[model samples]
Target: MAADHTPLTRRQALAALTGAVLMPLADPAAGSVRHERHFLFGSPVDVMLRHAPESPGDAALASVMRGLQHIHAQWNAWKPGELGRINQAFREGRSARVTPALLATIRSAARLERASAGLFNPGIGGAVRAWGFHDDVMRDGARPAAATLAAWRDAAPSLAQIEMRGDRVASRNPRLQLDFGAYAKGVAIDRALDEFAARGQGDALVNLGGNLGAMGATGWQIGIRDPFGEGLLASLATQGREAVVTSGSYERFRMLDGERCTHILDPSIAAPAQGLVSVTVLHRSAALADAAATALLVAGPLRWREVAQRMGVTQVLAVGPDGRGIASGALAARLQFASRDWRGRIATV
Candidate 1:
């Protein structure tokens, strides 16, 4: 499932209860850890800086927060932001001028969407809203009608149809409405790290909800949330610049007729994806890791490795609905499980 669009107090409470905490391991000798938490891109973000002087770290934190706010203002599709204006222009069959940063993001998203064979689409904002996923609160209700799904299927919106001429962007498919919910947090995290790096604060970590990136000589230990139940399923240590992102069915969902429906939509079916409970990917690029995790989850248990190979993501761990975990050999070698008898199989990718 995709990350929640906004911070939900209830969700936070649930996370606390379930032990789904994303925290850096404590090490006083590793230098003082300066940490801050903020809500951005509809999710809680945790910023941690290590081995930095107090003043510079604080300034760097402030800069990163401002940068994150700027990104939120430009890309938040639910609000009256640049993305909303762009969508309006699309509906009017006119081109919209975009900032260089946004244009770059659009280009990257389009490439990844094509690379994943359209499994990771940002051009399904219409479907997202029709299913009531755009709302801050996902209320339990009936699924979208057959006609609605059929219309969406017929439109077949894809980012590949977006044409960019200089800074102006127009879509051949008028039905296309861009929603970067799956991709923006990763971009923001990467940007936050960039801000820190610019300030000479390279030993830092940025965790936006579950999508996280870290860079440090001392490295970091990260906990992976259990998709099937409470507490963590495993942990991994990372050094240098790396991102670990997870897409899970438990993240954002609504009860429909006593059944839970996730927010991650399958472009082919124009419906909520199924099969995999969660998929985690480790990569150098947070944006790519975030998008790849979602795509792999949609690819499900049987075809996940195939899609992962196509995306050039070899380090992965996927959990199915049956509570069984599957890990790539590279990732499996690095993961430290909480229990000795954890049910999982390793695949060579």
Candidate 2:
């Protein structure tokens, strides 16, 4: 429901403080692969190129990072950005003109909402904030009061409450806030891919906090994280230009008064999702894969197939709370798991 508003963990915070960029594979046999790194979009943003980091080709890498920063600036809800201004206007019962990118995002979000049967809602910001996810990491690691949760549910801020006309956007529900966390990373990834291609840097892998997009004939090798525990659950090699996006309930959670509540809230319940631990989607567009993976994650195991079909994504892997993974046939063909603990738990759907 929200966009890339990630909470800082000890590991990530330390890495950012130390300026450590993760480049898992830097094989010289492939080419002169240079990595350009930055901490953007609440996560590590990296670009691996087949050119020198200080060369002219690195402009694309720099451009991609700057573009992500620009999008983060506009789409960030917690900051005093363009989106916040629009939300403030809505709070005062007024309509306001938004940038073209924001408008396009709203329009596409509306389509995704219908496509996911309302499972992927950008209008759940109130409930998202109610659980104290409005900041970098949860400042108050306590669950929201029962009445506060009820109020947000009763209000039900959804796409139905939003109104988009020409360049202007507004909402009828004052309590409804927009969080693009579910969609913005993918959009930024897609934009970065396009930007890289435009800059003549075709062989590159851009990862924005594990929502990755690869643009090159060489393809890319990606590792899927275990949701219930640490380390990798599996690995997959991309087929041509492909992107891999994973949404896990365990990635970000708040320790709420002796309990752990995840960040992926079910729009139906206005609470954190349950049952499944992670969902990963493979597609050409990282944006679609990002949102689709989230929808499938929220849908859990029982209904993930239907949601995946609705999202037009055929290659997906949904991991259960027990560490077992069920993925599409296409995804199974590309996945390679070396974990001995994962053999009996994986099956092709």
Candidate 3:
């Protein structure tokens, strides 16, 4: 089914512009938490970190930010860097040692792959490239040929074929090239939060393009983007000592053949997910929530409740393309849906 690619409303656009211009000036000395928004993982990222009462916390946060940036700088396939190393590994047809940090991430990726039954494979780089999502190759209404799709489909590595032995990871199939875009940003946030916490930061919230993680006793409020209405889908109001993450097909897309295509390519089908438009999850860790969002997207509505139950996720919310949504048992009980008088919206469940 074809979907519509909606641009941000004037208000939303203004908010984004305001955030971009004002975020860099946010310093810890302000005695309040600051929200910093940026583009990463080929998607938008927003981070909220509490200011440290002392100069040391400020310096620590700044250093943590720099480290996060470096991780993305080296590993972002959209640009160029350590991705070439992965490419090299593929060429060599052998396992490669990744940085301790990256190894932790890849190990998490492997675990998610096993959990999702291969639906969230990282070895879809060939398919992603062929689809022209890596570069601006889809410009001017470009679409890959059926033959190219066939080649990628044939070459893409199965999750089962990937081998991860701590700091080293390899693919049984030489054609398999890994792309962790689906979950890397969340992992980055997790790492950043960990680093900040280790430095004695009181409370911190890391939003790597949308995926978010928070540490400490202070709970954060998050506004869920509405799919068919004005403003937030709903706000999660709680002060949990955990992290929250959300993802949606509503962001990042290119039009082709009179069809709107999103950037969330399902490794199982080598195409973007169908039916669902947005999915959000709250959990103890950003990595799990982020990976779960993708897996739920691929699973669609059919297996959502079951998977969420199996994974022991705290909560989940999903909006279908038809403007209908369902919330998990946990979330339904926790969040207060928007009122119609104010937003002309209603929530069932």
Candidate 4:
């Protein structure tokens, strides 16, 4: 799920063949693991639960899937959902009422945007659309003109411009179109994990694409994919109640003017981010890990450590455009390289 970005069958097969395996229960007669895969947010959502035969695992899984659907209906920017309506309100210069959950997400994004010093902005939806990334299928041909990119860069839209009063929200900057593609999946996974915990099914894993969260007595083993190749770079075991997320240029990219353009847009340049090939962050909160991965990727190699420190993330792994990779000492300690030939260095930070 971290890379290859291939179809479901191949990706799942590769994960299984590699080291990203779920631990087997001690007593097969006592319990079984229920696994299901669904499509949401233009990506696959995989749910795994280990439960006793009489436990309501199926029911819990259904509830969690329904919750994810609700989230997609509310937050999907391309679809005619709550997010669409809010974008319409922004265009009309009017305030729109939002659900409590949506409000909380927006506020949390604002906080993270500030914490990352605008490196992880969600208010560049207009720029994202201009780059032809708003549609399920990317628009082909030439890239957006330099003038268009300059206009967006000059506008400098940010999530901080969004104003919220009770349930109503408005934006001071008309250019501030909200896009939570980088943040929503993690939040949804967190919610699903919470639901599993609430149902006394603490032994569960929710993986939305490559961003995932897990909880159990003995945690899950996750493989970090090589950014430049199909093989996995390393494997690590997660602790209880932890999320692992990776942001990379290897997936969700389009070829424009013979150049591969990624989906992650840097607000400062008003274009797809460059320099770093991928970044992975491990944290207790999936949302934070997701956002931090993007921020650190945009930060690139030189500034990623500073940004990670500012964001209070101790575990991080980043790979540059070249084959060079760096991991925070905290993360390096837990990583088990799949091969000794891996080109990774550890930093104390």
lDDT of 1 by residue, 127-243 (tens): 998888899898999888989989988999998888899989998677899999999988988888888998999899988876889999888877777676666666677868999
Model 4: colliding residue pairs: none
**What digit string (tens of lDDT, one per residue) describes model 4 on residues 224-264?**
77676776666677788899888998778888998989999
Top candidate by TM-score: 1
Candidate 3 Cα errors over 4 Å, as ranges: 1-31, 34-47, 92-95, 136-140, 164-168, 341-349
TM-score per model over all chains: 0.92, 0.90, 0.83, 0.90
Candidate 3 all-Cα RMSD: 5.7
Name the lDDT value of residue 285 in candidate 3: 75
lDDT of 2 by residue, 1-349 (tens): 0111123233432332221111133344667777777888888778787754566676777777788889988888889899888878777888988999888888888888889988898888888888887879665467889899898888878777778888888887898788899999889888888888887778888888778888777666566665654455556566667888888887778888888888999998889999788888999988788889889888988899999999899998888877777878887766665454564577877
- Which one wins by TM-score: 1 or 2? 1
Best candidate, lDDT: 1
The better candidate by TM-score, 3 or 4, is 4
RMSD of 2: 6.1
Which residues of candidate 4, in runs, are more than 4 Å off? 1-13, 17-31, 343-349
**Which 10 successive residues of model 2 have the least lDDT summed?**
1-10
Q: Tell me the TM-score of model 3.
A: 0.83
Clashes of each: 2, 8, 3, 0
